[model samples]
Every structure is written in structure tokens, then in C-alpha cells.
Target: MAVHSLLLGVVQGATEFLPVSSSGHLALAQWLLGFDEAPLPFDLVLHMATMGATVLYFWRDIVDLVLEWLGGFVSARGRWSEGWRYGWAVAAGTVVTAFPALGLKPLVERMIHLPWAVGLALVLTASLLFAAGRLPRRGGQVVLSSGFFVGLAQGLAVIPGLSRSGATIVTGLATGLKSEEAFRFSFLLSVPAICGATFLELRSVGSWGDFTAALPSGWLVGAMAAFATGYFSLVLLRRVVTLGRWRGFSLYCLLLGLGTLALSVVRG
Candidate 1:
């Protein structure tokens, strides 16, 4: 169980930001390991660990954005700060993402049990990346509408094969933001989303105490590995996005999707 957790942790952290579907990859890993599905407690732990990595990576921006946004209520100068606008944009995006994502939660879990469905979703993710790669890059800032659209993409990305970062970054680009800005905002936007997910997972577990007591083997090592690998994955993804090299990720997703589908066929 520990070994499985370690591998899944690495998979979760590594792909969570790389425009590849982390959930899909996890499903493949679990399938290969002879597990029917990942246990909920373990899933929650992995999510929190990876979320921690994202928070640490962007801690500075997060602090500034939060402080500036709060300060705006009392200071006129604070209202005009970039952080204020970006903060609201993130909030708006989170609201927009809530509807579809919440509505599809049940379906998303069901899809996790279907490997072929994950493969198809991966194909969809590849297409989205390909389209975004073709769009012209711009230096525009994120606004309410941009947040809304990207949120919509993120909402739909709750599906196992869909890539949250890929979908949001693509939508961010289509909305005219520059590659780096889009990359930054995409992860910034993820903070609340992950928090919300963690909350839900906690609720589903009934209580943190009960949840912790029954934690599966290897959780600590798995979580630590996840955080470590996830941090580096963020660094690698930053370079990839800044270089406008999404087509490479696109190709990777395409091949992986096809291969997953092929394996499904052969096994069935």
C-alpha cells in the first residue's frame, strides 16, 4: 500500500500542473496496480499535499493579492493596485467554476471508474491544448469576464481526463492574457478550488479525526513525495508555458490517450 501510495503521489504531483490529467494518470496507475479505485482518505491526503505545493510556489503573490484586496476597503490607493483587480478576478473565477463543477461531482466520480472514459477525456484535453497553442498570445490582464470563461473551462475540467491547468490556461490565453500571466493566474485560481475540494473531502470523511485514524499505509511518504515532486513540476511547467511549447504537451496527451484507449480495448 505504501509503495502504491508513493507512485500515485508522484503521479499526482507531477501531472497535476503539466497540462496532463492527473486524475486520469492516477486511474491508469491504480488500474495497473490491481486496485479498483483509490481510497477516499488517501485521495484527500494527496490533494492537500499537492495543494500545499501550489500554495508555497505562489505564496508571495497570494499574500500580496490578499493583503491588497483587503486593504482596498479602507484605502483608495489599494483599490487601484494590480493585486486588487487580480484578486477579484480570482474570486469571480472561483464563483464561475463552482456551478458546473458542483453539478458534475457525481458524474466525475463515476467517470473515475471507467478507464475508457478517461481516455476519451484525455483526447478532449489534447484538443483543447492544441487549439490554445494556435491562438495568438497577448499581454492583456485578467478581468471579470476572462475569469468567468476560464472558470467555465476549469469547471468542466472536473472530469478525470480533462486537465484543469491546461483548460484554464488555454482559456486565459484566448481571453488575451500573456502566457506567463495566464500561467500565474491559472495556479492562483487553483488555490481556492483546491481548498474547496479539500473541504468537501473532509466533509465526506465525516471528521478529520476519524479520517486520520483510518489513513492507508504510506500516506506520509506519499504526501511528502507528492509535495516535493509537485514543486519541481511547477517550475518545469513555468518554462514550458513561457516558451509557448504547449504543442509538446498536446502531443503527449494525444499519444497517452490513444494508448489508454488501446489497452482498454485489448483487455476488454
Candidate 2:
């Protein structure tokens, strides 16, 4: 991969795992760089890199959950086993949240072309985070309603400048989950959601030949950078969340959104 593409991948990989909106920054970067294509394939590749990092970072959790879910799927009355019951809840949440998101892809793509639309979404994201920070924490309990609500928020984040982590974490907090729990669940929720999106894009291998041919070098660099940055970000976020400092991120988001809006108006 060329240096520019490598740098882009590094940016995507690092930012995607954090509460900051990777897509939003990437769009802005592309526009600033005067790149013709917005690098959808590259975005997918970066997502895949993050997914791999997630698996590495949370391998133990993933293994236990898979084992539990598999045990539940094979058994009758599924609830007979403790592991089986918890597994079903996760599966249910994953499936329920994914459907609406899948249904709305075309709509999201259409809206994303408008710069102001993305700017508005970023502002909305800031609002969600700000509100969530003010609420008192409740012990994290994963319930259907919480799952559904967070899923809806995640769907909304299809717009540029909306962070998936920020949306889900804010919703989780609003639902009264403790900050740590909210953060944990938000990260867990990302596994299936991001993986599904990546799989869909990767399935059509032919359309992405040029991108794929460049992947080996990019993937190595991107994956390592993502893993290093993501691991640290997760740890930092967990600590900051415990301290109830999510409000700082809201300020950051607000500034970025307003800046993007200003830039769009000036350029137009």
C-alpha cells in the first residue's frame, strides 16, 4: 500500500475503536485531501482490522460467550442450564438490533452525502453523551428494552460523525447501567454489529480486487496500529467512565461538529 493509504488505514483503525467518530473524521479527511472516492473498501478493511483487534483483546469473553450460546442452541428448554439462558439473551439482542440497521443502509448512504446532515448527527451524538453523563448510574443489567433502545441508537449512528461506541454507551447509561457495565456491554455489542458489516462487504471479493490486492501490507500495519491504540483507548475509557468524565468527550464532539459545519458553509 502507498503511504497515504497506509496513513488512512492507521487513522481509521485507531479512531474506529474509540468513542470518536471514525467515519466522520475519515469523510472530512477525504474531502480535505481532495480524494475522489471516499474509500468505502478501505473503510471496510479498517473495520475488519478493528474487528480482529477486538477479538484479540476480548478473546476470553468471546470464547465463553460462544460456548454458552452453542450449548443453549443445542439443548431443549435451553433454560435448563445457567449458561444457556444468558446465551439466548445475547443472541436475541444481537439479532433484534441488526435487522433495523440492515433495513436502513440505503437510507443512511443517501443522507451521508449531505455534509450538513452529518454535522447535525455529530451534534446529536454530543447531546446524547452530555445527557448520559449527568444521569446517576445503575448497576448494569442487560435487559431487552435496553438492548432495543441501544440498537436503535446504533442504527442512528450510520450517519457520519456519530460514534458507534458513543451512541451505544450513552444509551446504555441512559438505561441506568453503571458506567463500567455500560462500557462493557457497548463493547460487546460491537462484536456482532461490526463483524456482520465487515462480512457483507468482504463477501463480494470480486468488486474489491484493487482494494484487496493492496490489503496485505495495509492489513499488517493497520491491524497492529488498531490493536495498540484500541487496547489503550479501551483501558482509558474505562477509567474515565468510572470517573464520570464523559462530558469532556461531548465538548470535543461539539467542537468538531461546529467546525465541520463552518467549513462546509465556507466552502459552499
Candidate 3:
């Protein structure tokens, strides 16, 4: 069980930020390992770890945006600040994301048990990544409309094999945002989605005691492993996006998606 947790943690972290789908990888990993879905508590912990990694990676931006946004209430100049606009963009994105996400909950849950569907979704992700690489820089700012469209992409990515980061980043690029800005905004937008999901998981967990009973190590292994790898993956992905090196990830997703589909057929 510990070994399984460790391996899944590694997969979760490694794929989470890499334009590859973490949910896809984790679901496929669990299926291949012949395990039921991970315990609810540990799932929460792993997600929180991802959230922590994202927060740590972009702490400065987050802090500055937050402070600047907050200052807007007291000063007109602050209200027109970049941070204030960026902050509203984030909020707008989150709100738009919630609609499709909630509406598609049933389908997303069904994707969990359907590896072939997940594989197809990964192919979609690869297409998005490949296109993101070729898009011209629109040099657009992260305004409400751009953010809203990106959020729609994020919402659709709730499907198992679809990469949330891939979807949002590509959508941002398609909307003419700079590559670096797309990358940064995508992750920042994820913060709220992650928090909302984590909150729901916590509410569903019932008791903390159930978590301890399931883990001899008290969920520390998954959390630590995920956080460590997730942080570095963020660092690596930032470089990859800024350098226009997205083709490699696009190819990887394509191959993985095809392979997963092939394996499912054989297993049947």
C-alpha cells in the first residue's frame, strides 16, 4: 500500500504540471495497479499538496495581486492597477469555470471508470498542446473576456484524460495572451479550482480518524512526495512554455493517449 501510494504520488506530481494530464495518469495508474480509487482523505492530501506547490511557486505574484486588489477599495489609482485588473480576471475565470464544472460533474465521474474515454480525452489534450505551440502571440492582456474563455477550457478539462493546465494555457494562447502570461495565469486560475475541490473532498471525508486508519504513515508520504515533485515540475513547465518547447510534451501526450487506448483494448 505504501509503495502504491509512493508511485501514485510520483505520477501525480510529475504529470500534474507538464501539459500531460495528472488525473489521466493517476486514473490509469490506479487501474493498472488494480486498486480502487485512493482513499478520500489521501486524495485530499495529494490535492492540497499540489495547491501548496502552486502557491509556493507563485507566492510573490499572488501576494502582490492580493494586496493590490485589496488596496483598490480605498484608492482610485489602485483600482486601475494591473494587479487589480488581473485579480478581477482571476475571479471572473473562477466563476465561469464553476458553471461547466458543476454541470459536467456526472460525466466527469463517469470518465473515472472509462479508460478508453480517458485515452480519447488525452488525444484532445495533445491536440491543444500542439496548437498552443503554433499560435501567434496576440500580446493581449488577461482581461475578463480572455479569462472567461480560459476558464471554459479549464472546466472542460475536468474530464479524466484532459489536462487542466494544457487546456487553460492553450486557450489563453488562443485568446492572444503572451505565452508567459498564459502559463502564469493558467496556474493562478487553478488555485481557486483546487481549493474548491479540496474543500468538497474534506467535507466528504467524514472523519480524520478514517484517514489515520487507512495510512500507517498518516498521509505524510503522499503529501511530501507530491509537494516535492510538483514544485519542481512547475519550475520545469515554466521554462518549457517560455522557450516554445511544447512539441515534446505534445508528442508525449499523443503517444501516451494512444498507448492507453491500445492497452485497454488488449485487456478486454
Estimated TM-score per prediction? 0.95, 0.86, 0.95
Off by over 4 Å in 2: 35-41, 71-86, 207-211, 214-219
- Output the number of the lDDT-best candidate: 1
The residue-by-residue lDDT of candidate 1 on 63-128, one tens digit each, is 988998899989999989888888888899999999999999899889887888999999999998
Clashing residue pairs in candidate 2 (N, C-alpha, C atoms within 3 angstroms): none
Give me the displacement of residue 151 in model 2, in angstroms: 2.0
- The weakest ten consecutive residues by lDDT in model 3 span 210-219
Model 1 alpha-carbon drift over 4 Å, by segment: none
lDDT of 3 at 75: 95
- Once all C-alphas are superposed, what RMSD does model 1 give against the true structure? 1.4
- Per-residue error (Å), model 2, residue 16: 1.2
- Provide the global lDDT of candidate 3 against the true structure: 0.86
lDDT of 3 by residue, 79-139 (tens): 9887888888999999999989999999988888889999999999889889887888667
- In candidate 3, residue 245 scores what lDDT? 82
Report the lDDT of model 3 for residue 161: 91
Evaluated at residue 249, the lDDT of candidate 2 is 82
